[model samples]
Target: MTHILMIPGSLRAASSSRATARALAARLPQGTTCTTADPGVLPHYNADVTDDAEVAAFIEEVRKAHGVIFVTPEYNYSVPGVLKNAIDWASRPAYESVFKGKPCLVVTTSGGALGGVRAQAHLKYILNGMLAVIYPCKEIIVTMANTKVEDGILKDDTVLDFAEEALAGFVATCG
Candidate 1:
């Protein structure tokens, strides 16, 4: 079975990013398994500390997954602090972390028109620095995301279909 780990960049239970991730997870093909990681459960990043069980588990999730999907929302023109904290935790050993060569697909959502494009760019750059193999595909930006998601799931068919298609292509590369 192909396992895909999804990380949402918001801690709010009703955030559009989490809703989008949930929707994507539910729509994956029969053979693919989707697991969502909660970055909120992790503590702030600190280089001085080591041997954090939560951090270790988070890294292991990335190491074991066939690919990763980041669903994030823009906060003040950048990725949220909570998400960055999780990334920092898993980004140990510099260029040789679990993210090294790990396939990643990015999807961004926003309440505004830009759809978290800036945050997406920032995230891709960070992932590139970690040597993660970013999936080559059109950017998936869900604008007016606040209206597109409901009840903890993405409700926009157009956005969801496009994302699902992108995911299919991404999964093909995972093997």
Candidate 2:
């Protein structure tokens, strides 16, 4: 079974990005278990506390993950600070980090016309520095995401189809 770790770029209770992440998680292939990262409990990246139990546990989860999916939102044409900080925390220990060689999938949602293209670009570059293998397929950009989901479920078939296809391809490559 493929173990996928999903990270959403927002901390809001009604975050559209989180909703989209949950939607994608529901569509992952059978035998795949998708879990979202708990960045709320994570303190900002601090090398001094690198050995903290929470940090260690989170690192362990990333080390065991077969793939990672980032469901992010655009914040001033870049990724939110918290998500970037989380990535930095996970990419420590230089070339021996858990993110090394892990397959990464990036998707973005926003209320803007360009979705989150700029943030996606920044995230791709960061993953490159981490030596992660990122999927080179159609980027998933869900614009005006507030309207795409309702009652905690994706209400758009087109969006769901795209997510399913991307997830299927991701699983095939990583599995």
Stretches off by above 4 angstroms in model 1 are none
Tens digit of per-residue lDDT, candidate 1, span 67-146: 99999999999999999999998898899999999999999999999999999999999999999999868779999999
Best by lDDT: 1
Per-residue error (Å), model 1, residue 148: 1.7
What is the C-alpha local distance difference test score of candidate 2? Answer: 0.87
Per-residue lDDT tens digits for candidate 2, residues 38-115, read: 776678888887467777777887888899999999999899998988888889888779989999999998877787
TM-scores, in order shown? Answer: 0.97, 0.95
lDDT values, one for every candidate: 0.90, 0.87
